[model samples]
Target: MALSPCGNQSAVPTTFLLLGLPGLWETRLGLCALFLLLYLLTLVSNLLLLAVVWVDTHLHVPMYLLLCALATSETCLSLAVVPQMLVALASLHGTAILSYQGCKAQMLLSGGWACTNCFLLAAMGYDRAVAVSDPLRYTTRMGHHVCICLVVGCWLGGFIVAGGMCGAIFWMSYCPGQNPLNHFFCDIPPLLAAAQGVTAPSEAAVLLLSLLVLGGSVVAIVASYGSILVAVLKVHGGRSWHRAFATCGAHLTVVVLHFGCASFIYLRPKDRYTLERDCLLSITYAVVTPFLNPLVYSLRNREVHTALHKLLVQRRVEG
Candidate 1:
């Protein structure tokens, strides 16, 4: 199959094959069971985290609010990729083909949510910095209205970025090849690789948008964290300094992992699309990061632990 140029597109095949992981057959059952377990755990853990943050009045603070947002993002991020992956694992086709519209929709939502998480992490860092640097005015500065606006802005920015990327990608023409993507979901790099040599303008469009979203988010995150580091160091008390640093450690861990893997995949030029390496990096952000975020944040948070114990006690008393 050959893809025509962007403007001169002919009737190309509508379906595209999704090349499943290489050597997957040897451990299909194990991989399926492992992913199924991770998916289940991710849903349960994130939902529980959201519930704890939402129902507990003591947990109703900016930090918990950020946690709730992260939990929600984790749920959506897993949903964007895991279901399709599970279907492919359960089937012998070994390749999941998606329609053009389906591919576009998946890319839009996934990209949008991923970008939102990037901004959210940066916002969370800023929130922490404010709380640490000016503890007396933390509540007044990060008021409810301001927090709500920040969250809304993160989502809005994500939508704008996603829409632009989707527009660029779909505007490009596809070639008349088997249209096999070597990843579970419709990511930008794999999609671009599949449509390579089709058109120069379309390729350029995708590359530009990818760099813009990835580069812009990374720069914002770095700037936010740079200020956060300065704030942490300015605290006089040793205990205060330790606490401030601890508060940000989890967020920083996730930011680094998410941005690191994403930069590896999206920021590189088109010639660097190595299927195996890309697949590994995709799993880092797509699968591992979502699974790890709740564990890292909730497990380290004493407030969540206390709330969970109270919840369990209340439930037991009711029972």
Candidate 2:
């Protein structure tokens, strides 16, 4: 906690102002409405996927179990950021102020849950590879216990990573007058950008740590998919190829969207930041990505679709 200059009291760096969507004044309301719709869609779709997976015995396999865990993470991620963003967007000047506790909480949720989603994607990719490459050994290799361990590891690892990064950010002293963060929620770059002074090293460390986590997951996903590709090509069966594509395509789409949107390609020096573009990227990743995740999973998965259809049909029959 840093001391506020106004009074020599133990003042935490509370009340951060988020600049939700700067320079988009004209379209802010429309964007807000659009994101509100997308937010709701993400919630409903992921929750439905979870519920479907939970009750349906057929979706009890490792792949579907991983997917269910993913949906759960996505639901948590969206809830952590979207509602607060909506509130921020409705505010005057597109600035939403958050307490230190709230800011740190959002960072933990978004950061940890995003890490969970990334690792889950990698895990899902690995699970698919095992299925495609060694169908016979898939069940034996990826037993229920192994699957549980993988999911738990992802969730736990994400929290540890996020806790380290957020703790680093929150401990720094935020200078007055640098209150407006370019993104909708409290994130690493923005928080460091607004810190008092001499934070480059800390910021670099956080970025490096984040890259390490993401990079490791990416390596795993690429390796899994690469092996999957080789195995699918070696097998001259069209059905095998189709199955491989169906399993990997959705996961790949999600990977591309999530990483592409969240990547720091446009991240220049702090003074050179283009806030509107940054906010747009944040919004796309935070809002649109979650909405797309379950859509891709559900449409590509026949078993899940079948389960969902049966559930609806049974409800209608009972009615």
Candidate 3:
């Protein structure tokens, strides 16, 4: 409710201090530079993916629409976390400060966008399954209206879940004296670690809600891929087999990296959470994974490569 600097007074701290990777304090500036570079590249690549999808009418399909949404989520998630993280890394004390409201905003956006990506990935997996299993009806089943509804549902569901998570976490009394977050961002674990009056029911509620989002999405992805694998095996052509593997390979790679990093961070017991190790591992999901999505899809998806080439050639002719 009130703000005080770290050493300003012996009053309740209404602000949070983000302790950036303390183990690498001496190299904070270097880390900051590296993160900044990654953020820019992530933005450019994701934006290019969105633009390519938008301009290439040939890609105006359910799958590419889901990808466009994923790119958007990745961009927003990076924006929510990376800029403030850069500030923390560049701070003289290797820390950054955030007001209570600022911290909640960060938590909501980061959580919402991350959740959106998970759902979107599941939706994409289902799209691919339908494509492989029932190509003739793929267009009918995944029509434009259906895809739009799915995208809207994913965004709405993501923020709604995030809102509930944030509300539950922030409802408790924060430990005023223990206002320093061990991680660079106002993540759920760090915030819970610093909060007082955390009851078993409240913690269980939060954990259950998280598991519902993640666990449900994982089940959907597995089911979709299982169907895909069955259909691919039923087919008798190398071309079909090659297409299925290439497409699923890219999506599976991303799914593994994204879900693996998230599971490592959120699904573990509280006692196993070493702040230092967790903070280091969070960079993979928070930064590296977003940066890798465009690359993985571009390298693995032949249609994307052809679209990019066509766009480049069109630009050359126009220029």
Candidate 4:
């Protein structure tokens, strides 16, 4: 039982209250509707991408396999954060309560998925690099077993890093009457603020772990893209260079959006944190970027369009 501000012990288990998107109760419903629409679109678009990848035998290569993993990660990330955000927004006071255990689970899932995506993007960059650099050897280099291992490694590394960070953050206890979390979901910065008994060592540990995950992934992506650039420039024909870049440009766009948003939120100092500003930025990574991923990939990739068309045509013929 946690002690309330009035010095009364609460009989119920301790929980954290989320003050969703601070200030704007009048616009909460509108925001809720908008987020719902985006979440639904995210689900549909990612699912369609997954279905296309699954049904098209032509897409059974390394690139689409990595893309399938990314789509899955985006959907899971949104599921972990957005529904609860909508519930919080629907509250009359724009606040929602989460059980202590529930909050921990959310932190783990959301953080884990976010980390997983960074690694997956990095893997995709490498896949593209290999495909462009050595087309004849691409299939052998990125065999099914290799892709499987990469996917498994990304997932494991993400969860392990997130578990460590979450462990460090949850090491401290929160008072029942502490200020509500400024963000909709259970994230690190707001939780750090509301927690008591947070020591310098724990804070330093979390920061170091974050740097390793984000910084290391950024390094991997840059290296992969650098190799891709070298390979593209070495190609003899104009069409070859154009084709290679076309394959990589969409990925670069997503990498920019995701890493930019994530870096802004996680890599910044706690002193620079603001309720309204961080919350809006959080929505970008958690909601908007996921929503944009499928669009960016599908709109730009002719292979995806062709695969989707074939799938639709096959369905009609089967019917």
Q: In terms of lDDT, which candidate is stronger, 3 or 4? A: 4
Tell me how far the alpha carbon of residue 179 in candidate 2 is from the true structure, in angstroms, after superposition.
1.7
Worst 10 residues of 1 by lDDT: 1-10
How does each model score on lDDT?
Answer: 0.79, 0.81, 0.87, 0.88
Candidate 4 segments exceeding 4 Å error: 1-12, 177-179
Model 3: CA > 4 A from native? 1-13, 237-239
User: Residue 204 deviation, candidate 2, in Å?
Assistant: 1.8
Against the hidden true structure, what lDDT does model 2 obtain? 0.81
Question: Could you tell me how far off, in angstroms, the CA of residue 181 lies in candidate 1 after the best superposition?
Answer: 1.0
**Whole-model lDDT, model 3:** 0.87
TM-score of 1: 0.91
Pairs in clash, predicted candidate 2: none
- The positional error of residue 120 in candidate 4, measured at the CA in angstroms, is 0.2
- Give the per-residue lDDT of model 2 (tens digit) for 1-319: 3444433333545478887656777777887899899999999998899889887888898988998898899889999999888888887776688887788899998999988887888888899889888989999999999999999999999898888888778777764433668778887667876787566666666767677777887899899999998998998878988888887888898889877775662224456556666667777888888999999888887888899998899889999
TM-score for all predictions? 0.91, 0.91, 0.93, 0.94
RMSD of each: 2.8, 3.0, 3.3, 2.6
| lDDT over C-alpha atoms for residue 30 of model 3 | 93
Scored by lDDT, the top model is 4
lDDT of 4 by residue, 229-288 (tens): 788788778897788779898999999999998887887656677788888989999999
